[model samples]
Target: MSEASSSLAYRLRSLRRLETFACLAAVIVLLLLPFVLPDFYVYFAALVLVTGLFATSLNLVLGYGGMYQFHHAVFYGAGAYAFALMLTKAHAPLWLACLCAPLVSAVLGFLIGAICVRLSKLYFGMLQLSLGSLVWAIVYRWYSFTGGDNGINEIPLPNAISSTTGAYYLTAVVVVVCLFLMYRIVNSPFGKIFQAIRDNPQRSEAIGVNIRLHQLKGEVIAAFFAGIAGVLYVVVEGTVVPDMLFWTVSLEVMVMCLLGGWYTFLGPLLGAAVIVGLRTFTGAYTEHWSLILGIILMALILWLPEGVLGLIVKPANSKMELSAETGRK
Candidate 1:
């Protein structure tokens, strides 16, 4: 190989090592955070991680699978309600509710995907948003069962994990496990098929790929994870509300991924951390936190279209691309 090629390979290897080190350092800090920080910030830390997982779930479809989903929070809402209902009405064990919450959302995803998977672009987004909004409205008004607009309050958690610190640890465990599974999924052959369909639908279909089935499956996977995020939220917060089911919830999760650089696997997680951190700190001081966040996001989007993390990774990627182009020439 040429000297330039050798240097490029060394640089890429060094970058990957740095990336891995950073990830490990983050995990360690999070593991030790509850012990170090005050009680309030511990809860705030849990919220950031939960929201990060939620954003990662949405990115699985929108960024990786090329789906246009507008009301992804419907499944998230379903998960929260399922967990809340199981606790309050069914008197189910915590483990059982945890297992079932995501399943309920997966079922919801299947039903919605069956209708929306065949459509594309604007129509798919519109149909999903409409159907999801309808469900949200029903939940909001179903006072007989759902507690209506006021929402279910002071919901109980399994006694062993009731404390905020304990709940944060539990959230950490679930989020880490789910993130590992997602990492495997996105890099697997099945995930590659999603990419195939997204990149060349006609060719993929010609080669016997069932586009709709893959798309629907993607929906189920994303929904299941999003549901897990909802479960974490309710478990940590000890409340379930109608607002959790709203379209705005979906927008928040989606925006995090977009802001963090949707193309990269870890971007949504970073994006979630940044957004939630800002909200927590900013809201502590001023009521106009949303405006501040909006302005900051606007600037990030204009300057670093890929994401904040994208800025860090861009140099390595650009150098690789340049090397490849030089070889081609």
Candidate 2:
């Protein structure tokens, strides 16, 4: 290899090592956060972790699979409500309730995806929004069953994770595991095929890729993980509300993916942290937190189109792309 080629290879290796090191450091810090942070901040940190997982799950379909999951929070709310209802109404065992929650979300994903995947782009998104709004409406008005708009409160949790610190640890572990699984899914052959379909559905269909089936599977997978996030939120907050299924929640998650750089794997997680931070701090100071957030997001969208994490990784990615082009020549 030429000296230049060797240098490019070295830089690529360095970037990989740096990424691995940064991930490890982040894990260490997350594990230590509960112990080090004040009580309130610890609780706040837990919210970040849960929201991160939720946003990341949305990113799996929205960013990687190239699907617009406009009503993603429907699955989230479904999971939360399922778990809460199983515990409170059905009197189910803790283990069973926890196990069934995500499954419920996955089933909803399948039913909804089977229909939504029939359309492309804008139509698909619109159909999903319509269906998701239906679910939210039911939950909002079903006073006898779902407690109506008032929502279910004081949800029963296990003794082990009832404490804030314990709950934080549980959230941390679950989020890490779910993220690892999602990362593997995106890098797997199935993920590559989905991306191919995303880039060129006609070409993928000509190649016998079964685009709709793959899209459906992607929806189910994303919904399942999103359900897991809902379960975590319920565990942490001990309540389930109709707002969890609202259109605004879905929009917020979409924004998280955009702010974090949905195309990049960790972008949504970072976006979640940035969003939570902004909401918390801005709300503390001003009554118009949403206005402040809108301005900040607009600025970021204009200036850093690739997202905050995308900006950080852009140089490395550009170098890698250059190396590939040179080798092709």
Candidate 3:
């Protein structure tokens, strides 16, 4: 390789190492935050972590897999409902409930992904949306089981982590672990294949790749994470409701991903922080919190189309075009 290319490669490797260290340092700082911050802030931070996890799962499909599954809330809500039912109806322990919740959502994801994999991109998204709506409708109508619009209340937290501050620390640990797992997955060979499929499914298939299987695998993995986020949400909020399964919930996850800059691993976490911070601050001052949020989202979409992180990274100049032209000459 040329000296310039070698230097560029070295710089990229150095940057990746720096990023990994920075992420670890950030997680350590966050774990220590509960000691200094107020109770409310700790709770807020926990909520942000949960929201970030949910958005990151969405990114697994939309960002990496290039499949827009609009019904991601199905898995999230399914997880929450699973936890609630297990705890309330079956009288299961907190650990067991949490474990079973993600398993249930993973199964649901596998089933949905299996069926949806046969359809084209747009149709698959639409079908997922329809299925999500169906789940929401059932949750809403079934008052006897789900408590209808009122939601299930007083969900127990893990015994070892009883206080909100303790819960915040626990959640931070989980979020860090999840983010690390996601980072590993994205840097793995499987991730390369997923990105290849995203760039050109036909080309990947021609190369002997099973596009459907890869897509389905990605979807199931995404759902598993989303399910874990849902369990965390129930723990933090101490409730689970039908509205958690609604289309709006799914849209919020998408918005978080877009706002964070879908291309970067940390983008969803930053996006979730922004959203949660805005909501908490804005809702305190005015009754029109939704209007303010809508305006903010519109401004971000219009002005920062690539999201906040994209603005920081900046686009690389296209030397490939010049190289191709020179070769032709």
Candidate 4:
């Protein structure tokens, strides 16, 4: 190996060690957070996890698969409605309601992606936007079922995890497990195929890759996770609203992914946390919060164009490392 390659390898090893240590420390803190934090803060953190998971689901498609859809949050809303309806109307068990949420979104994804997959880029996004709007209109108009503008309310949690503290811990554990599974999926062979298709669809197809089928599965996978996020969101908020299914909500998630650097596995999560925290806190202090948020994002774009985690993981930036060494010396 060349000297540069050796140095790169060493940098990667050191980065991995740092990441592992940080992760362990974070896990320890999270485990003890409920005991130390106020009840409201714990509940708020649970919602933040849900939001982060939702953004990560968007990243699975827009970042890794190189697909853009303006209506990705349709699955999230569908999952939210599914969970809410299953609990309130069907009277299903908590576990069963959770299982059905993702399944419902997967079905929607499969059906919608069947047509959208044949189209390229902007057309795919527009079609999804149209379909998502159609669903939203239906949900809004169907007052008998969806509660229309008022939305479904007063959702009761299961006996096991009904408390505020119980729900927050459950959100943490579920999101962690789901994210780990997603990390494994993204690094696996199937993920490689998705990346290959994203990088070069024509070449991937020429090499005997089933482009449409792979894309379909990717959409379904993304939708399934979005569904999980939505269901958790409903449980956290105790209600399901039509606004949650809007295309604008999906745009917010997309922005979060971009803010955090979609190329990094944990970028979406970090971006979600930052955005959610900022919106929650800033809204309380100022009426010009949206303007302030725009300024902050602009700064992030200029300084950390690759997203927040990109600051740590850019192993090939030898000049920056050298500059840091010179400063230290």
Tell me the TM-score of each prediction against the true structure: 0.90, 0.94, 0.92, 0.89
What's the lDDT for residue 283 in model 4? 80
Collision pairs in model 3 = none
Ranking by TM-score: 2, 3, 1, 4
- State the TM-score for model 3: 0.92
- For candidate 4, the TM-score is 0.89
lDDT of 4 by residue, 1-329 (tens): 36556666677789889978987887888788999999989988998899999998888888899988679989999999999999999999888999999999999999999989999799999998999999999999999999998899988886557677887878888898889889888989999999998999999999999988988999999999999999889877888999998877887887788788887788899889988888888888888976887787788777777776766666655565774455455
| Candidate 2 residue pairs in backbone clash | none
What lDDT tens digits, residue by residue, belong to model 3 across residues 1-329? 36556666676689789987987899779978988989999999999999999999889989889998898988998998999889998999777998999999999999899989998689999998887788789889999998999889877666556578877877788888898898889879999999999999999999999999999999999999999999888877788888888998788878888898987777888898998898888888898977887887899888987888866764442354444344455
Which ranges of candidate 1 are over 4 A from the true structure?
Answer: 1-22, 321-329
Across residues 94-174, which tens digit of lDDT does each residue of candidate 1 receive?
889999999999999999999998798789999999999999999999998899998888787866576889989999989
Better model by lDDT: candidate 2 vs candidate 4: 2
Q: Which 10 consecutive positions of candidate 2 have the poorest summed lDDT?
A: 1-10
Q: What ordering of candidates by lDDT runs from best to worst?
A: 2, 1, 4, 3
* Candidate lDDT values, in order: 0.88, 0.91, 0.86, 0.87
Instruction: Give the residue spans of candidate 2 off by over 4 A.
Output: 1-15
Top candidate (lDDT): 2
- Quickly count the clashes in candidate 4: 0
Overall local distance difference test of candidate 3: 0.86
